[model samples]
Target: IYKHSGELVAKHAFRVASGLDSMVLGETQILGQLKSAVRTAELAGTLGPKLRQLFDASFSVAKFVRTETDVGAHSVSLAAASVKVGERIFGSLSNVNVLFVGAGEMNRICAEYFVSYGIQNISCSNRTLSRAKDLAETLSGDYFPLSDVAHKLEKFDIVLSCTGSPIPVLGKRAIEKAIEARRHKPILLIDLAVPRDIELEASELEDVFLYTVDDLGEIVNDGMRNREGAAREAEKIIVERLVQFKSQLDRKKRIPVIKKFRKRGELIVQIELEKALSSIAKGERPEEVVKVLSRAISNKFMDEPSRALNNDSTGEKLSLSEALERLYGLNKN
Candidate 1:
């Protein structure tokens, strides 16, 4: 009832498009992260049945996208786009030394992408030297102190930054000094952070090519068009899955009614059993007492319904019987 329906719908759409699950089946970071978020909400008691249903539907839709369509085949990711942009600018990423400004997930992904492109001269710098060193060691890149960026910025031809700080991590003046030190060599800088790690003024420099997250939008849009047809097919699968989930939810709504009916039946049995025990205390034989109690209780329960059916002349009892059968899972067919 909290209306998580819209969020669930969007989550389903995103998981299919983001290559979190592709036809080729690569790494599944996005899907795992989404599931973890849902699980956290559930643990916090913030998730209701509606949201739970929606998330379950989203996961099912993601599965359908992976199995039923080729949308994920040759998928283009943000990190891959960074590497592609690097290749486009320098013509060969192998000769370009790469530097990452943060030890976050995005930075790690970009570093991995660069390394995969044979770019061995890589360096990582962070506010915390230990974190930077850890990421550098895993990627086999050199680690630099955050303060060393001023001295070392000129060393790398491709600079990718995504720090969490609100302020710009790389200023125009800092890049200006780095550019002069490199003797006007072309440098491609990618800023994937939201608040923007690289200053916009740096783009005005002659030899520096700076790209923000917004700049990657055009590239991502172009790649998305190629997969539009498959996306449409995946949408159809998602709708079908949602319908099935909703139908199951509707059926679950009948559970309370069934429970109430069973509770009433138990009460009737308990009352009759008490009466039988009282008769046993008055010297009734145990075997005959049990047999008589069973028949008497059965007759007492069914007598009213038998009399009503006999008195009804318009087949109303048949309708009631059908309704009860449907409710209690006693339908003949």
Candidate 2:
């Protein structure tokens, strides 16, 4: 419910979407979260032009930072770190089988990253069949019900679980059985849920490497420290963006003044041209008509500024020529 105005909101949104404020510095998942939140606000009728503009600028800033800086080039998120750990163990993921235990946002992101690592066989199991199927279809993987996880566990060499169950989804016994079924082949288990998805005792099992959210903290912190330079560069970009956006807004505010001035000038030109044309039609000299039209337009254009300069009611020391020079950025040299 925090409210901000002017550049404050813009700055905050830019930092957040660029991942400067995230635990994993430059993790791209926050950008999607921000976009989703913006879309939700739009559907709820709470998004306005200013907010939309700020978010649009934020998206651009995030993309620019990622492209220009190495902010997102390193493994930052727990999900990505998990994939890295898996790659370190298996040397490559193309031949390994991966199982994602939930179809939530975090799992979705993790699945996408794993697929990018060339994982050919990926499966998803969730409490809801439809959600699991949707995520599986998106990743070109198989979907199964949560109840089938135990039976299918042995087939996966890597298991990433982030379900919201209050109790542990896979205990030591379940993992032990899976290990026995695999003939003691090694398995990499990553539990990313807050309350813990895999049982704590599962870490003690042979041929199993179990890692939890706490285990990923060191990696996340290291990533943050490594990206400090890139983060500074991103901050500079945000500052420049703020100044640019403000300049654009200022120009937008002056548009009406410009339009009004142009309209008035057009009207004056129309009146002067008609007068000159009538004078010529009435047999006046063409040269005289041309001279009168030029002088009349120039006089009309200067009249308001001349009067204002003469009045000098604002107590400023600017002379007529100086005022005109300042207004138009004219140089005497």
- lDDT by candidate, in order shown: 0.78, 0.89
Question: What TM-score would you give candidate 1 relative to the actual structure?
Answer: 0.49
Query: Which candidate should be chosen as best, given TM-score against the real structure?
Result: 2
Residue range 95-199, candidate 1, lDDT tens digits: 778889999998987788777768898899999999999999988889988889878899989888999989998999999999999999999999999898889
Clashes of 2: 0
Error of 1 at 291 (Å): 90
Lowest summed lDDT across 10 adjacent residues in model 2 is found at: 312-321
Residue pairs clashing, model 1: none
TM-score of each: 0.49, 0.67
- For the record, the alpha-carbon RMSD of candidate 1 to the native fold, in angstroms, is 11.2
